[model samples]
Target: MADDDDEGGFGGLYEDGHWIWDDISKSLVFVSDLPPKPVEAIQILAKAPTGTVEFRDDVDLIEQIRFRRRYQRKLKPGQEDVITVQDVKDIALYTAPVQIMSPLLINMLHLPTTERFIRALILYSAYYLQIADEMANRIMELEKKIRTPDCDILEHEFRDNLADLRLLVAKEYSVMLIGGSDMRKFHHMGPAKKRRSLSDKDARLFETLLRMCVQIVWLALGRKSFNQIELETNRIFKSEIFNAVEHTLKTGYINNMAKEERVVLLGHCLRYDKKLNTRSPLMNEVFCHRPIDYRMMGLGVIKVQQMSPRLHYMLQAVAGPEEKLSELGVVVGILGMPRSAFDTMLRPLPTAVEKSKASMSSTSGHSSSKSTASMGKSTTAAHKVYPDVVLPRKETRELFYPPSFPDEPEKIRPCSETQRRRWQNRLMKLLHPHR
Candidate 1:
């Protein structure tokens, strides 16, 4: 860490209405006017200059031609102006694709560990939402401008803003590091005189937030997966199981293991997948099903994932098919497991897929075409694990990612009543946990 007066110092953490740190008292402070609530912050972001540019559905062929003509730039000194017929064709066919920032971390309102923590969480959410919204808006602007004469100028502006946005993101993360310190006093009213790094639990939360930022940035850059981003920020602290859960969300698998190796992997995934409400019977079945079952011991999958590396090495290849256990050593080295676990799961002759397939085959098809279509749907559904927690898809799409400009009246109102109720419930819990 740098000195308070220098660059990357504590001075950078202070913003008029976000956070402040008092040197004499050695305590971090929250500004009286914190950032807007999550939803309101999003609304604020959506009103930015570029944010107002929207996707339109009524652009005619003549309008596209006009747009293209406007974008034709004058050649500079020593520059060749080469416009091929293909270029014209491309301009005529171009249509902007609707891009969306992944909502997993953006919309999620976690239960803060302390009441004081809520302010920091909300502030961070505001910053994250701002950057995400700006990036999306800039993209839309670029799409529109690229077909007009001001394309070059607009591109320059977009580039400059992109750099500025990255800096804002860094400052946001810094505030989290500073804010996570314990600042409450004996009376719990004023600041404490002790300064320290974030606690273990708080550090985990910070790491999660950092990963979210990275994921969103990568998505905005048009990357399909966060693998590169995740690897780059690997040093950020997170429990292995939690890391696995994130990996599963981005990629449909846990660390690219083979089918047989997936038995334990899938089990861990099921245990850690945040989508499923834990009390569900399916969760119990997955917990008891085998390889890494922690039911009898009363331990959590996360605890096991973070256990001693030496213990994992011992249990790495205890049982299971030869092919699946081949890389089990490496898997165990990274994620520890219990002894006799793999052997227990291996005895079940048929895999989950085989069972599902057999059941489908047993049912005779009413018609060939219907059967074929049904099989395809079933197979796809079998693979896609729909999230148990359904977000306000309608609202998110309209506010954060409207599919079309001049959004229809029906599309704009009441994003999701369910989401509203859930957020209220979470807020109540955070504000009055004991109640």
Candidate 2:
């Protein structure tokens, strides 16, 4: 570790050649090499006044002096950005992700322990879940208003509100996905020495929060099937959440676990997958039905139900008698599986038509048509049957007028006296909620 008062020291665990001591794993890890700095002479020359007859050659030396002075006043850890539990709670209640999530995420990286990180993650997931539920309710309300003939909300107002809500949902979901990816990356880097073992209680709560995140994601996608969500949302989901989950399942931070513990952990992963499959049939067909050989268990096959009792007991102990696991939402279920298992499970299986085509020299057009028809049926089945809040078939002109020009300010209409009174009452109600 570098001394705090040492001049030109890298500070903390950082050392020369981009190597840093990982206190948690008790090992030295290689950080990435620093980006190349521009040559001082060239930079100084480039910044010289245009077409100058004479330029000061000592500018580089002067710049170096200034840099050294600024470097001497480097911020202590106390001066760095800090986020508190209350700050996160307040942000979740009052602000949109667009306004604060990025800075909040950056500050969370400076959190000192695994427990604190998990707590922050849980708060973020809860915020996302709340937003998703609200959006769903708002959409339902909008649908009712659109159907009511006497509704006073103009077409433009309705469209603009729906667009704003959808945009908000997308932004919030993106932040959540990024946060989840960063959490997995941080965990994979090894735990901080101060908080080596995650408590079983925190672990279970983290798992529940992850499940809630998945459910919120599904809700944001309009509760559509995987295939139906393939267009806009699928790419983002796959790139961020799917990739993060896949990577974590493959290379977990379990280097310190004993052999028996590893086996039990693997069993838990399989058991969770089994339970999850029961909840999502599509996932069951995609990943759980296939047989996987666990080399950690000496290439032995373990039945999905073999570990059920132990997992149930663990859940029961953590959750107590009154709570149901189902209330936590959909399980992300593959967090602890090995990389080989994940790859095998994700591999696409060939259909009967493709198998027959390989055997024959040429395939009949009938086979292609039949496959297309089946695909259409699946698409239709996956598609939302209800009227979409976003897309309406009937096109109507906006009821609101365009903005008035500065020269013709009289064209700008003022709010009606009734509308002004209504807004005043609403503001008063907000100010005095109990009243």
Candidate 3:
């Protein structure tokens, strides 16, 4: 809202590639849409003994991108460093689509309306998860039930249900968010990531989902349940998933190369667990089935344990008198919480489980982060909704990264006049939908 002459202004927005930007106040500029949190442009500049951010307004085109960058200081006092950016000219002045969708507003890709949207998504997600949980359990039960009797008649009955279950499984999509990819070359590699074509919005979310798919598939493989359900994940990563990921990644910016890291690490997860190259003090590695990252959901069975002490009783009560207590172990295991509390209280009933497992659509499927902990959060929630929403993901090739600005640019805030017009065009569609 401030003027270009004012610290952090919009003058550059109105100008073409040829515009000067000097509206930087010493205060940290905050743009909710920008990733890894609002970068302290002044702080990054303060690190420079002779750092500066000035826009060059002498371009051949009208959309003279207003650019910004600086030399930086080291952790040690009085030490200065120049982080060399080879395409500094292009990068420093590029305002990108990733930048445009970085804000929470653009997150409304599927959430056309607000207040009801989140609750609706939560309800939708809860129901979806409930079904997934049921499907997983049914898959377990059916496998156990059918395997006990290897008669031809039982096999035929199982096959019929198997076809139906597969169709059910394919009805919905599950999302996963990988934090980063190993930018470093995987020479000691076997199969590479697959190059499944994805839009920028999808690029960010699907890649993570792809990584998770690899892990989940591996988990299923580990459990040795090869033929448990109906239509498998269409987007499920095969050996080609990694190839697709690596193939696309090699085409992106070096800084953005970490996407490959996530997929590669996932490949490693398929073969190894969390102990991919590094080992824990306990010599323990976390497996995909028991992802340490599952804590993000905040409302899963894991969190339920924190709320009560009688969950174990509930789970036990769910089993029929003929069923052993061990059968319901998965209900507790997938949650990774103290089962004695709530699950113990609301014993999972077979009929209830069967009802929840009934097939429902699942569209399961974000950007960068500063700290590793928050990275997935910024870029992931969209993937949380998965194949349903149409959002942008990082593409394999980005012809233009958004030009750098004095500070992080806000969502819908254009760095060049041309971009403003482009956004305007999009706004027009939203304002006047063709019904």
Candidate 4:
């Protein structure tokens, strides 16, 4: 029987046998009719490498297998991937570039609310820095043009562009400050319902963001204007908000300040005291207190309320039938949101009452149809077609406008001429300061 088995198995010591060469062992081995176990097959394959394999040790091989399998593991049903600190950092760094930053930052707003605040801080900081660099470059160009003896007239076009740029910067600064306060409140009373302090990394990022805010303000409004506004804010708040801000602006470092001090300083920056009036024309325009409840409009009630008041006002203002001081395009451009998205955001959501009413009407209509059918009455209701009132979607034509430019030029006279005169006066003062 053994002789017969050996002859049948091709010199193997197995019943119903086959023979296979073991490349690693460099010998013939008997293959059983039953297949090898997965582990055994893997070991055999690992040992009998056809080519050079990087994993030399069993531990390394196991680690490689785990690494590959890690990505393959699927989440359980209804399980959401949690956004960790690392994820936020990656997003922040990815959107740090100037060219791609704005749109990406705008998109971050659509992230899960849990992650939005931190992302907002980091991305907004980077954005502020980008705009600061741009404003600095523009200012340098204007200065160079002024110094040029051949350049006699400060062109309306250039001045207009600078003014618009300044206005954009101012609006952003105000929005940042207001948004900061909202973010703080949000985190403190987050979904967890626990007071969450910033991690060391987040704290550092927040400090840098606050510093950039100060820099943005300083650059947008010149030192003179900045000083006047700071003094007024100090008087109104009776706190060292702007003083700390000035120090941060000048030093470009907040490491010296304690965390509590930094927090207080941040609070001051984001604080919008109704009585507080900077009195400077530009400052007043930038930091106006017009508290409007967006919940009434049923447009992102919670999210919008938790956002910057100015931003809320801007959204509301743009949704108006009559064009307001801030154009939808300008707001959209400043926020880096696409026109379509901005319009969608402005679109009102139906209230719970309206939804219930709609359902009730639908049910009643169905019941009425059933009864009408039973009665054998074929009465069709006449539907009235109302004229569609198209809301004018205003698009910005020029890259720049006078500071006082309104949405509708026809309805409201543009103060471009006055702005031009002011620009000329400013240029004249720069040229002959002694006079």
What TM-score goes with each of the models?
Answer: 0.20, 0.18, 0.20, 0.23
Pull out the clashing pairs in model 1: 55-405, 70-148, 70-149, 71-148, 71-149
Model 2 regions more than 4 Å off: 1-166, 173-213, 216-224, 227-383, 391-435
lDDT of 1 by residue, 119-193 (tens): 222222222222232333333455466445564444334333222222222332332334422222211112342
Evaluated with TM-score, which candidate comes out highest? 4
Tell me how far the alpha carbon of residue 76 in candidate 1 is from the true structure, in angstroms, after superposition. 52
State the lDDT of candidate 4 residue by residue for 306-411, as single tens digits: 4344344333322221123233322211122211221111111235224434544553332112111111221111110111111222223422323542232112
Q: What is the lDDT, from 0 to 100, of the residue 146 in candidate 2?
A: 50
Over 306-419, each residue of candidate 2 has an lDDT whose tens digit, in order, gives: 223322322221221112222332111111112222111121134422443453324222211111111122221122211111222222433232263123111211212332
Model 2: per-residue Cα lDDT at residue 225: 31
Which parts of model 1 are misplaced by more than 4 Å?
Answer: 1-162, 180-198, 213-223, 229-435
lDDT on C-alpha atoms for all candidate structures: 0.29, 0.28, 0.25, 0.29
Model 3 spans > 4 angstroms off: 1-151, 174-200, 216-333, 336-435
| TM-score of candidate 1 versus the correct structure, residues matched by position | 0.20
Tens-place lDDT digits, model 3, residues 1-435? 245565535343323333343345434333343346553121121121100122222333334322221211112364222111111112222322222222212222212121111222222222222233323333335546753444434333332222222212211121111211221111112114343322343444433322322223322111111121101122122222333433433423212323322232112223433423632211122222322212122221122232122223332321111123233332211122212221211123344333323411232211111112211112112112112111122123323323531232212211222323333444445446893
lDDT, candidate 1, at 6? 66
* Pairs clashing within candidate 2: none
Comparing candidate 3 with candidate 4, which one achieves the higher lDDT?
Answer: 4
